[model samples]
Target chain A: MDFSSKLLEQAVDEVSQLPGIGKRTALRLVLHLLKQPESQTVQLSEALLNLRKNIKLCENCFNISDTQLCEICANTSRNSEIVCVVEDIRDVMAIENTNQYRGLYHVLGGKISPMDGIGPSQLTIKPLIDKVQAGKVEELIFALSSTLEGDTTNFYIFKQIERLEVKTSTIARGISVGDELEYADEITLGRSITNRIPFENSLKN
Target chain B: MDFSSKLLEQAVDEVSQLPGIGKRTALRLVLHLLKQPESQTVQLSEALLNLRKNIKLCENCFNISDTQLCEICANTSRNSEIVCVVEDIRDVMAIENTNQYRGLYHVLGGKISPMDGIGPSQLTIKPLIDKVQAGKVEELIFALSSTLEGDTTNFYIFKQIERLEVKTSTIARGISVGDELEYADEITLGRSITNRIPFENSLKN
Candidate 1:
């Protein structure tokens, strides 16, 4: 759409570059910013720039952090030997929110997606291999999504450290806790049966 | 959710301040930015800041513009006597998209909603009255939204300039073109019937 203001057009253009926002939504957002006090726009712009300029990445886990090590990696109480491998920080946050996991995390930054031109080299797969090869981590949990890219990345990592003594396991996949088995997909229902644990093991959890 | 990184938390907080974005979506957007090259983040930040800093408002109509006068107000071919008064730039864009109107516009910036602490004084209402008082505009079109706030604003503006010689009209509202009559809301259907125009006028479009 043609804009009377070049500034508005440019703002809309840049905002539309984000993942889910389209031109119309970007225009609406920009216009909303314009209606507010100029200080609001300044605060938003400054916040965005400051975060990009000063943000630090954790040296060990490759997670976005304010220091050399992330909060999880820096904490002494959390089990450093048990690391949960994730595709990104969002997964880390999701797992942390559940409060069931008390181990360190290894954020791969992204998964390997050949269709998107992203390879294992583009991610932190090398650092993860190096970490596992050192025999420091006792158990490495693969907590990536169940998509094709996630599977590909997990398989590639598993192959690299197959010789290592570390016990590697992927997160369980089945019908959600409250979901009915009848409505579940065939693959999920079949997998749930094949991977079923003993009644005592289920009761323990 | 507790963030491993303070910078990530700050960015998420700022991004979540946007109209539709919540914490989870904000975190997702921030992580997506981190995955991309740092230059992408810089570009996004700079675009947002530069637009807010350098933008100009049109002198004639108070619409967002890159020059002293907006495109429509500056165009000599368009009818200066016919002015379309709208609530904001989005309305200007919506009407412009139709390619139906050749008139200029006056953007009020917002409707006068007391619940939102918005009053006529907070808007460009005074400037609009001054523009009409100049006796240059022959007709004024009220193209605000069809809401209580919109109607109140329109009525207020109408009362302010009732003594003027200008002809005033509002955009038509009814069941949309090709929309089923049964599904249309009661108020809209009733208004469509009460304000029915000549059958030939409907065919003219």
Candidate 2:
């Protein structure tokens, strides 16, 4: 049977645009929302809209924030002398939820992927270098994934920071493999970050 | 671990509120968006906001719309003589995707459920009755499910329409059960709707 209304079609079309949500999943979501009270549906819409509109990246660490500097970067109570460098904001959150790290964060935006045409210049490495050279920092923790790209990024960052006389470390590798940070549970990621080891000179096993 | 930033915590807390997303899923989604080009992440945020801000329900059918009347109601090619009654807007879209039915629709908003305190008066049933009485409709198709609530709703609607002269019928049963209309595949739902049976007055089985 044909949908007699365009209004319903439009809602489904919009919902299907989300990641991993197909036409069928979008249909289910839209139908579920329609069954809810008007107020509740409105809240969902408002929350989704707010997720994008009200939040931004902190200029200091590049983590998502509602202000200029993300709360992690802005909090004075956090360790100002040690910065935990990560590939994305989610890493910052995972680490934060564990309450293990009190230091600040610097989001690399992404790892070095030459196949994807993402090189050293494309990342936020310059800011990290600058933050290190500006002094006060005694140790920099590398919270990157254990993927090939992540290893390459770690080596590249090590080369960049070696000239500055600061120590560099990376999150332990035993808990992760490949480009799979998205699937790592919080406890595993947390343990990896807490047990970070000194960055080695080579990328080989 | 204690979060270094309260803002990051707040954002994660907000993301967890979305349907089917737990804290870990929320973190993954948030981090994925963070790694994307700023423009793409910003676009997703804007889309979410627009979904809530711009889309409103059609005053007549309560289907989501960007305008006063949904596209189906405004279309001139659709037949105004028959109106298919459904439980929600999802049913409307399901029928539409078949490209079969060429008539209008009446969304009941929900099936009757005494446990949930949803009676006929709580739904758009009154509006449907009014629309039928005022229009030139010849057939009223009940596309509701065969669940207990659906049966009660169909019986109530049948009683009300008995006074009118329109040819009323319900979609075939024995095809689905246990409030399963929402789960029916489009083909099954479409076929059942096409092979609707007349409402029998006696329990002759």
Candidate 3:
């Protein structure tokens, strides 16, 4: 597209480089910014710069942090004996929103996807094994997505620490609470049926 | 959402302030940037800052520009006597993409919408009239959307410059080139039928 100003063109190009934004949407966003007060743009730019320049990752869990340890890893009241392994910080936020888990977490960075050239070596798998070898963790919970890559990563990590004293388990797969049986996918509905718990046990939640 | 790092949270909040972005999408974008090298984020942030700080609008047409007059206004070959008035720069880009219409443009910045507290005084309508009153323009083309506000803005500007010895016309409305008649809306079909041109004239393109 022919932009009247080189500066506007450069900014639109940069914004459109993001994952889902297209050139037209980028132009709309940039034009909206132009219509706003100058201070709004300043704050936006400064926030991004400060994040890239000053952000750090937790040494123990590899989650984003402002210091050596993340907030969850640094907290004393949370259970340190159980570690829920997730693919990224987004999973951390999702699990936290549920308010169901009280244990600490370990971010694997991503699942093992050979098709994408991301292997166990590229993630924090070794660090997780080292944590398990230290013997502080009594239970390791696999909380990755239900995709094939998630299962592969889970099995790979389980094998690495299998002989260790840690008891490993995966989050359950079942029909969501509000979903109808007919709407459920075959795999999920089948698992929910085969692994159906005793009626009284299901009432605890 | 709970962000372990304050810097990351701030960046996400800033990004989510854009028109269509939400908190989760903002977090995903921020994490994507974090995974990339530092220089990429730096370039993104700097581009936004530079654009907001250095950008200027054209003096004659009120379109975005780097100099006193925009490129179109400064071009010698384009007909300055014929002007196509639009709501904003997006419309200018849309018309330019068609590769027709060799006339210059006047961007009104926005249409007259009382619900949004926008009126003729809030737009560049006066400067457009000034252009016509200068006695150089021979034809004025209205190329706004067909919404209520677009029509209102078109008529408001038309009354302001009607006394001048210039011909005025709006861009034609009709069923799109590839669309079937059955799928076309009633108002559009009615207008297209009532405003039908000679069959030979339709073949000129």
Candidate 4:
């Protein structure tokens, strides 16, 4: 109906743009922030501004990173030879939370979705193949979703790696469908990782 | 487990500090923001930063305003003498949404809460009494909560306005609880306004 100030209206508009937030909820939040100490709102603004400015994608895995390389890629104790391929950084976090995988990661950014015009070239496949071609990587684990695009991306990776003679596998898809690897429970995800199936052997006839 | 960058971590921490957000939800939101274009994020940051800097408290009614006097107080058609005293600006918005009330508002900022150490002196009661004593005001509406603090604040306001000989009333408690006026559905809040009871009459019995 009526707003007190342009700034209040602006703030509510911005907050409502966020995922899952509507106009009413945004207004409530803006009012809540108004009641808190000024420093709290200042910190939140600083944090949001800094998040985009300071964060960069890791050169190695394309995951979020403070340095040139992500923490997982830089750690010497991690298994560099067994690389886990994921669709995005969120997947890396989900898998890391399981505490079972000690391997390095390769973020594809996204799967091959022709509808979205995202093909293999749009992904980090060239670097992935290069990493595999370097001769140190013993096994490559496919942890992409079980969607059609994910399946197509998986098939492309499997075909490319077949020429190298390296062990290749895909995380089990019996418990998953569509593009929801980002929100799967830890137990189901952990189980999928543990029960990975050999793509080459499964397809051999 | 592992974060992409320190800025991302800091952003997540700041987002989680909001009223109902937690760490996981904060991460999800941060990732969502990250996926958005830089222009969108910049707009959000600008909105948040300008919230306090651009908005001012209306001098006349204590409602938020971009100018010295709020629109409601400046309106010639509105009944300035029939001030609707409310807890905050949200109540003002609620009333304005109905398109029924044409009276000005008096924002108390908050009610008297002894446990939180808030007292009558901390509220806008002094100015309200002054307005009533100025002899222009004919009726004062108490739109505070139904909670103990709201009742106490109402009693304190009633005493202050008693000597002014101006009629005083409170919105019906049947519609809302203390601090919950912000969430009352429009119909209920409007009904409470229409069914207001005289504070002086209630005290007489």
Index of the highest-TM-score prediction: 3
Each model's number of backbone clashes? 0, 13, 0, 2
Best by DockQ: 3
Tens digit per residue, CA lDDT, model 2, B48-150: 4445446566676666667788788888899877888898777887788877789888878789999999988889888877877775778999998767998
Q: Least lDDT summed over 10 consecutive residues: which range in candidate 1 chain B?
A: B28-37
Best by lDDT: 3
Residue by residue across B1-205, what tens digits does model 4's lDDT show?
4576788889999888887888888888888888778878788888887886666888989998889998889999988879899999888999888776888999998999999988888888899888888897899998887779988998998977787879888765456346488788787788778777788865743
Q: Report DockQ per prediction, comma-separated.
A: 0.71, 0.18, 0.87, 0.58
Displacement of the residue B164 alpha carbon in candidate 2, Å: 4.3
True contact recovery of candidate 3: 0.88
Better of 1 and 2 by lDDT: 1
Instruction: Provide chain B's TM-score, model 1.
Output: 0.97
List all candidate RMSDs to the true structure: 1.6, 8.6, 1.4, 7.7
Question: Per-residue lDDT tens digits of candidate 2, residues A130-204?
Answer: 889889678899889877999899889898779897888776554545748778878777887877666783354
Give the distance in Å from residue A115's predicted Cα in candidate 2 to where it truly belongs.
5.1
In candidate 4, what are the lDDT values of residues A83-198, reduced to their tens digit? 99999878998998878799999999899999988889988999999988889799999999877888899999998889895899877544544648878877778887887778
Q: Compared with the true structure, what per-residue lDDT tens digits does model 3 show for residues B20-124?
A: 999988998999998889888889889989999998888888899889999999999999999999988888888998988799999999999999999889899
Please provide TM-scores computed only on chain A for all of the candidate models, following their numbering.
0.96, 0.74, 0.95, 0.76
Q: Which segments of candidate 2 are over 4 A away from where they belong?
A: A1-16, A23-81, A102-104, A114-117, A175-205, B1-16, B23-79, B114-117, B131-136, B173-205
Arranged by lDDT, best first: 3, 1, 4, 2
